[model samples]
Target: MAEAVRHVQVIAAQCTAMGPLSQLEKAARELHDALTDPMLGGCQARTGEYPSLLIGDDLTPQDIDKAVDAVVRQAKADGAVLVLALLGHGFTPPQRTDLYFMVRNSTTQSLRSAVDVGRLITEAADEPGIDGVIAIVDTCHAAGGVPDAGRLAGGVRAGRSRLAILTAAAADQPARDMCLSLSLARTLKDGVPGAGPALYIDRTLAETLRDQVSGQVIGRAEYDQDPFPLEGLWLARNPSNIANAHADVVGPLGLQDLSQSVDMWRGPRRSPGRLTRSTLLELEKFISCGRVDDELDSASRAWVDDVVTALLEVFRTKEFLADVLAGSLTSDLLRSAGRLAGFPSRAEGTVPLRDLLEYAVLRAQPLDGAPWKGLARFVAALLHEAGISHVDPRLQEWARRLHLVTEVNDAFGEFAEARQRRALRLVVSLVGAWTEWPEEVDAWLLHGSADLPLHQRFPCEPGGAHGVAQAIGAAMMWARRELPHPELLEHVDIAAPAHLLARWYPEEEKVGRYLLGAKYSVIPRWSGRLDEAEDNAEINDAARKALKKMSSCAAAPVEWIDSDALLDRSALEYRLSTGQYDAAIGVDHSPDDLEEVLELLLPFAPIVLWPRSGTRPDQDQLRGLVQERWHELPDGLAAAYRHRWGAHQHCVACLGDIRTVWHDEGWLEFCRPFEYRVVTTPEEEA
Candidate 1:
């Protein structure tokens, strides 16, 4: 295991814009040197990365954004003690809601033109995975950056932000030039006089920095709300000979100031790392894409409590895991964790539990659909056999996050990811009457969730049976250029409003002309749902239900709404939205009558299929085919068509109106803003 790095990152920013303020520059430089001192906890700013913000006449929000993002990201760790020392003037905008680090070009109206310290410091202070913060703000209204008490520890359990904030003055007052920064530097460089062996932030250091400040100083820490108070932070070593004499003796090795001597003994430093909530969330979404889950519904939050509990158990006894999970595959899987990603250094043997957990999460988290032959595969297999296969892929992610499992199972995971034929999503959206050629609408052939969609605009003459087919043909031709194996596409999911669904679309590929309708298994979804906010509770719940119901494909069919039941739209909406229904079949409704079909069913029912406008095939055969090929979904829809298209009467029912929807709400979530789960690979520090 790597030695813990107490001060993981040191960032000191000053906004002396037009011309440099010599005193602020000197203080910020001194603070950086003090924090990076080997004796004052090991933080080495040797990555050629600047330790201070480079503000000037040319400064822009973009520059500040990159600098702040890089620094805070580097400090992501459960053991990290981040030292944020700012020497700028803190200016709260008119509303006094957002505090900005004022520069020569800064203003209140356009926040983008200024460095909003609230966005920069206040928010970053409470982010998960940061163990502690020692913020020394030396600007006017410095107290503005201090978050409300207990706010840091409120949202999460184990990854709580416990920190001591020391500011130059009260929220309404002005600050003395560089007083707080200089005081912290001096206190750290020269140990606290007559203090304990290790300096703690809240009690000792806060008082020291406060006394050194010219005027009143404000300090805040969240210890009152912390369930298990963090261990005393070794921020600085105490050199007081008198204080040491009365202290419980350890040995002569406890040095007051090892400024010049410590480097001679300690080996080269390797940075300590912990998975942040954002990175873990991204990994969860990446794995859960195109997958279904159940609704015990812990999906909304990270399972920090679980991993912490497991780590505690591992600490009690190495063999305790085996005893707890006697017959299960969990113990057998964890036995392989020693060989997993290095929680610092890789090896196979007895190791500390904390390192083991970190390694388990770090190694197993694949940011893309790329094949990762790691512990996730085995854990996923174990979960599948427990009677809930693919029921909430997050379960596999969270459980393994709590820690590990055995060797590669390429058969299941590899084929699903690598050899797996990716989807070619075709979307049709109504433009409304405001645009020219009202029938001239938008269509997209999506390559992947992250890839830019290929778009084309064309008018589909209403009731023009060939209009939808011609549009599909054009998209197919364009899509084939991109696919390495053009022949490998299983089927296409057409997402459209009811008018478009009312028409029949034929598939005319180079292979031959065959009615594509034989293949579609409509899964309802609306493009507008993508516009809804992430915090939309109603949509989020409905989407989760849709994702959860995907597994019901294998279970016996529960209920399907028919034409008579679908007539009363309100009644149908209530039944479907509140309860889980597998499919919605409309046998007699015309395209005009079905205008509101998607709006009502979308995001609720996983599958919705209505046959061609004219034909009403035998209901028994249609239901049987749906039940038989339910699990594979849109892909399976094609297989059912190929097996029964035309030769049997059920073929018309299966293929004629099958160009339906498979509106995987999870797909929408990932594509629109995957937000945290962007395609960018995480810069995880090992």
Candidate 2:
């Protein structure tokens, strides 16, 4: 039996009286043209070649209903997919909030006379023979009744039927004239080739349209049933004969050919002949003359593919590879090849071998015998040899593909275990150089816990901390090396301490106690003692003189806490309880007591707490303390106190200037007075 033909009905119910809705008529015409065009395989209408029954302003309410009903009946009888496109002005009547599509004679007050879009869609879904329905509404507030329409459409659970509803705007947003219709018509006309042979337009195309139009004109689509059956349903073949003719270019040339050619040029390690300068110059000339065809015909596109393949063959030569690696004239040829292969092509005076290798790995087609693995390995070796410590996204991708860390470890198999650890350290250091902390470190730290005292485990020289105090000491050393200015020490929040502590002591309570001790005890107490020493006239004079002699030296003076002072349990308790860090430090304390105090405090001292200056002990006393201990105090604490005090003073002076602007603009309900709260610190309670 011969199947009946499908039908498409486009109804443009434009209200001519509404000034803004004139574009709806044009949109309807464009949609009709797009649907009926032979390029898109739209059904030819019975009356003529055009494939739409457009219901324009001339159609009355009864005429529109009859026209729509007739189309639905015909579509059902034919067992065809019904495409319904509506372009008009929509309105929510004041008597009721439900939205309606205004017919030619319909008024805002008489919305009942207008088309009930939901009821119409429900009728279409009720038809048993109609397998699919595509309903598009291009009007202001088109989505207002979509939810109800969707529910009604799902009422009839007939055989293998699906309903797709597309709205020009979201329920809350207004639809602009011509925007949705034009974009959709364009997409349907041209078709998205990359999405395969499916006539089914997905959300990706909607997103593309949204990006092209104003944000307010965004469109939405909903399906009442599974859309899988629509996949690979062809609405139109490629209109461009040129694209059709050259579709097989990439397949025939094959990525394997390029990979094999490159391998031949690389040659065996024993074969030592290098590429000549003249050959490189000839390659460069060829690239300069090799132009990409803009016409996009089969012949032009095929020419481009051939030129790229030929360039790849030239790059395979060992001499050319050496010249490129050595920053010789062949670098231009490499850059040109990258451009031809559709990689980022920018002219470079000198191209690094690593970049060329990365480009090859990125552009190589996914095929058997492609040199992606070899190229990745070559790039990794170059990076290692060049001592390049920074990590890039491309390098990260290569690392994943090549299993970089594992390969690096395997390469050092001939060396001792200690040497292998050292080699891993280089890789870790490079990773750390780019990121503040790399996740790779967590695995390495866990696996190599026995070898904890290596340089890789600590941030400072002769690295490795035996305990909390040694870790704090290592952090301080790192601060001195990295931060030349004494003021910068306060800003240095040592992340390594917390990270190491978490791994070393996974228990929550133990980690908390250690962090608290480090935060309160070690930093503030040691900082206070340093302040007291700096205030001494004789020591200050001597330190200033010593500093002048070696102005460029990276090293800073170290203040060693006595072991007895650090170990004093009573003193540590007092400091923690009263927050009086200075009371715990003294020359009278023995080395053992100092060590105990340090052991107690090292865990908490990593995080420094700055006191609120506005509500602290007397303002005059605080200022005096700051001036005396400015250099010894951490930069973060100092800056916080300074900014707080300054802000408080500013607020007090500016209170009179606070005026409510909207109160004078006739918004009487919004004229409300507000008050500010005073900030207080813990020291104020003490």
User: Pick by TM-score: which candidate is best?
Assistant: 1
Task: Write the residue-wise lDDT of candidate 1 on 192-252 in tens digits.
Answer: 7766555556566777776666566656444323332233344555545334332222111
Of candidate 1, the 10-residue stretch with the lowest lDDT total is 251-260
Candidate 2: misplaced stretches above 4 Å? 1-4, 48-51, 94-98, 147-150, 158-160, 224-686
Off by over 4 Å in 1: 1-3, 7-19, 49-58, 77-79, 95-98, 108-110, 149-159, 216-230, 241-686
Q: What's the CA error at residue 539 for candidate 2, in Å?
A: 99
Please list all clashing residue pairs in model 1, or write none if there are none: 293-392, 333-405, 517-655, 518-655, 522-660, 522-661, 523-661, 523-662
lDDT of 2 at 262: 33
TM-score of 1: 0.35
Judging by lDDT against the true structure, name the best candidate. Answer: 1
Residue 504, model 2: lDDT of 25
Count the clashes in each prediction.
8, 32
- What CA RMSD would you report for each candidate? 21.6, 28.3
**Cα deviation of 45, candidate 1, in Å:** 1.6
